[model samples]
Target: MKLWKRAAAAIKDQKSLLAVGFSRRASYRNTDLEAAIIKATSHDDSSVDYSNAQRVYKWIKASPLNLKTLVHALSSRVNHTRSWIVALKSLMLLHGVISCKVPSVVGEIRRLPFDLSDFSDGHSSLSRTWGFNIFVRAYFAFLNSYSSFTADQISRTRANLRSDKVDSVKQQLDRIQKLQSLLDLILQIRPIADNMKRALILEAMDCIVLESINIYGRICSGIIKILPAAGKTDAARSLKIVNKATSQGEDLAMYFEFCKGFGVSNARDTPQFVTIPMAEVEAMEKMVKSVEKDEQKQEEEVVEKAIVLLEKPRLQTIITDKWQTFEDDEYCFSEKAIQEYHQDPLPLVVSNQPVCYTMPDLITF
Candidate 1:
């Protein structure tokens, strides 16, 4: 039989011996059985031996034996133990089996029968108590798992780095630097109270790193995209606008008009004018001239109609009532003199004519 198969069979058959107090009449002596178990769990360098150790460790962990018996067995054979794998396996099994009961309690609370208000009521006090206990257990379990996973990842990473042959020294150093930077950023963000904000920041970091990697890879592969010659193109365009402006008389006139409207003086000779191509200036001038000609034609037509109307000759109306007359002879006297005569308590003198009774005399009664 293979050494691995033999080791596995030995471990399986000796299970009763490894657990509670073994019967003295069992197949193998207690001392020999304990020796075989120690040898099986210990690292032997050979592939077959290591495989057997892994298999036995797995079987022992999955077994339904009580933890107290296992711990006792481990402690009794601690001196004979050649590896910590057995202890680790035992602890993992104990944790896994015992921890399974805690989550069901948590699920019960999570799916609680009563509403949130029931927490303060006396009648639902027992449910609240059990809910709180379960929540505490679940919270601690989560914290333990989180910490354990972090430690395991860190340990494995360190082991990989120490192996030395798997990667170059420079690559290892770069990875360490990146990890340090990540740790620093994590510390900086630790004080944030919002989970979503923290997650967004982490996601942004991931995206930035991935994009940078892609850009670097593209550069290394010599696949850079061509960009327009910025300096040459810009300079050429600017020169074109300036040359066009100097060539167009109408553009110069428009530019000066704009400057004047904006209160800009030409004393300093500063180029405050925006330039356009000569063709564009000519197009604009043509548009303006067309509009002006249309307006002038409309104005001339209106004046011609007015002249025709004047030539048609219409009769002017005259007022029959002398009080309603608007001729200048009605107001020949000085206004001040008339006002004074009216204010005097005497009648006006007429040149040898009989006085006629005015409407005011009849109204005096």
Candidate 2:
């Protein structure tokens, strides 16, 4: 049988795709692990952090891993990206080796505390907690906004962007300039220091908190569903809500511009649309306006019904109690949920998942 290098395993002359990670050194003769640790400590790369890798290496050499502290530190990717990555690499590699060396210790890691409470909604970082609920929610939003990730979708999206045949030379040049601006923005984003990842983490965490703490999302969804104005408001509201879907909307807009070579000069979050025939645009606009008018009338009726419902003491009490629950420190992803999770557990988490709490698509909203 042909000998192939093992994936994600520390090997003698193979590079790991992960951050500064290598297997435990079997012997001095087998220096694969040793070499990776040394490289990580001294150098920077697209994958590994110099210092974080070194610290991880130190822990590995000592044995009896500090799995709790190590895992906890992975949360520091908010500020220390490369360094955090190095630590992560080291943690995974050391854990792999340590687990095999002393299998009994593996169970102990499962008992370790996981901090998942980072509810930072694009404004500030929140504390960490140990839950995949938030992460699942963020994943849903990302998936919705990132519909262009696939080759098929990308092709279709690009096909949709058509420049007018009667466009003037000035328009063509302006389009090229806009395209170049998108490229520049991309360069800034590519540096990773542009806070792209941090923004995503914060935004993802924020989305969960925003949805959990408020009835706004539910209200919007309800309005779209129950109200007659839904058909009209759906477009505007969906655009607004779906606009918030991707944390990387700006980047995506730029990407679209890049791919289509079409001019996109609108705000980062707003979608850019290629102009269609004037008559088609007018017809669509008229339809949207008519729909909006119907939706407004429907919302008024809903408000009237809601006022009647609120007049009932029982319904008012229920609403008050529901709102009061937010005052408690005990929040989403309750202990009961965690216990249930143990029974029907998700797959073992690898990489960061953003470490998984900031799990955005839990139940697909």
Candidate 3:
């Protein structure tokens, strides 16, 4: 049954590819680009057609306008596909295109053109294909977030290049925290079942491992650079980040171990673990304490200043008369005069007739 479904999907993809090849709506070159995308993300997922995928990447890198065609073709193929193979391949192709780091592609693809968060595989029963479904969803989530991360990273890089100033410790730490978040998302792409050892699954897992290494390395480099400057920023915030990095290092270790056991070649060579020294953590703690103390001292000093200002004698004009004198002499008053004035209060005029003020009942234009 699986073989039959695979064959049908391949036939359908080939027919669609041929139809796109003959279509005159787009330029011949764009048609070819769309064809390449179709081929790269076809249902036959025994192995990824990286050649065709790279070709698409080259086309996009050459001219960013090709991205519109790419997005349309990739979205149509992925969104309409029921086969897990095609969905995964499409995601992998997108992942590669993003990896090319073409500024235009990165900026435009910050959010995916298609949604796969609720993707379900139709090639097999849900019970059997649940792992693939999870993998696809997880991969989609990571790619979506990672694309945004890449776009942001590129924007920041360009901004830094344009300016004479380097990124501050807070900026660096924020980037590291974001990379750590991406790592967490990538790590969630693990196979849910031991039987999910197919080449297609392994291929996707390999890519995940590679991305994890890249993100994890950047995170470690960032941590190293920012650790020395911890005192320069909010120490408590810095300390929280340091603790997360330490925990992420452990999670990454376990993630790679799982990858190696699950047959990812890249995981066999373990990346260097980031070890935040106890002394550094202690120093950060002390900085945090010192920061807290300084803030408390500032508050106390402000309070003391306020108290001293309050206690100090200040010249104040004293108005001995309780009554107020206005421009009208009749309104002038004194306490004793106020009592006499109230005793002989002015006469009140009471009108029994109701007087209504007319506001234009219906205003004319």
Candidate 4:
């Protein structure tokens, strides 16, 4: 009664005192507010009087303690807690200017569900986003928790994001962009001892098999045939990249002539090429034989299917046996066969270059 009387009197007579009280005790821990809240709400709106209860609630909300206290008091006293939370939520819905402590603000945002697509403002600016402040907090929360912003750099960026209320929606978006860029940079900096075997294998294939001297490698059928270039080696480097390796080359000098193009390797999505054993290619040939003729013809068809699936070398040397090497155009498909294979009638270029695979449509039958 005394607190209520004091509040009622303060609202009616001393508005400045109530405002000062709210200003000091809203965010800080305070002793007077709990007793005031209890006193202010103990009676019906008319009984304790509207002015007092209204003033007290306003003070509490202005203190920004309403949400913080509502969250802290949500426990076994479910009904009372629910009323407080419901009232706080109503206040949140009513006001956008109000701000609370970061942890409490984070907890409040955690209670709701949001779709990422809902926040696209479609404004031309890079910094603009819809659902501005709430999404900023939520996206930061989402990335840190799900994306595991666990790296030192990411953790630090997240800390910075939480510590400040970015001035505008655009600023919030920029902060997120900054954080992601930092995260990407961190990912690219591999520790000195850590090994990335996939990348290393791709580098090898890019260097050895795909660009290997006097050889053309295809992974689908897993063939690496050694071509006879003047500088081509009979003794190859690592053959771990292919299933079958044959010292065979198609002399395109008779079919076409040498030419040059861009020397840079800009190809993407290079699958891991490793040296598979001859046993695998043998097993493949045997598997072809194992398939009945009704299903697919013999080993030659199997090799052909492999070449087809591999989708390389418009002309490939189809060796029936391991000893059948390319002596001349007898084992090779004619230019007519090569020309008919391509649906697009673009004239093909045959080059006597060091690495023959660069000729996009070179084939051997």
Task: Note the Cα lDDT for every prediction shown.
Answer: 0.36, 0.36, 0.84, 0.33
Give the runs in model 1 whose Cα sits over 4 Å from its true position.
1-80, 103-365
lDDT of 1 by residue, 177-267 (tens): 3433332222221112222222222322232233223322332221111111113223333333323324432433443344334333341
List candidate 4 segments past 4 Å from native: 1-31, 36-70, 74-78, 81-98, 101-365
lDDT of 3 by residue, 89-163 (tens): 989888888998778778877888899999998867888889889999999999999988888888888888988
Least well predicted 10-residue stretch by lDDT in candidate 3: 324-333
RMSD of each: 30.1, 32.2, 9.6, 31.0
In model 3, which regions exceed 4 Å deviation? 27-29, 273-280, 295-365
Position 216, candidate 2: lDDT: 27
Judged by TM-score relative to the true structure, which candidate is superior, 1 or 4? 4
Name the lDDT of candidate 4: 0.33
Ranking by TM-score, best first?
Answer: 3, 2, 4, 1
> Where does candidate 1 clash, by residue pair?
none
Q: Candidate 2, residues 1-365: lDDT per residue as tens digits?
A: 11231222233213432323444422222233344444442212134343545555455445544443344333332124222223223333432333343332343344222222232233123332112224422332322222212223234334556642343333323332333332233223111122333332332223322222122233223323322322443345433333332223344455444422322222223333322234433444566677778889999999999999889554433334344445244544578767888999889756743543564687875
Ten residues in a row with the worst lDDT in model 4?
253-262
Per-model TM-score, in order, reads 0.17, 0.21, 0.78, 0.18
Cα error of candidate 3 at position 327, Å: 43
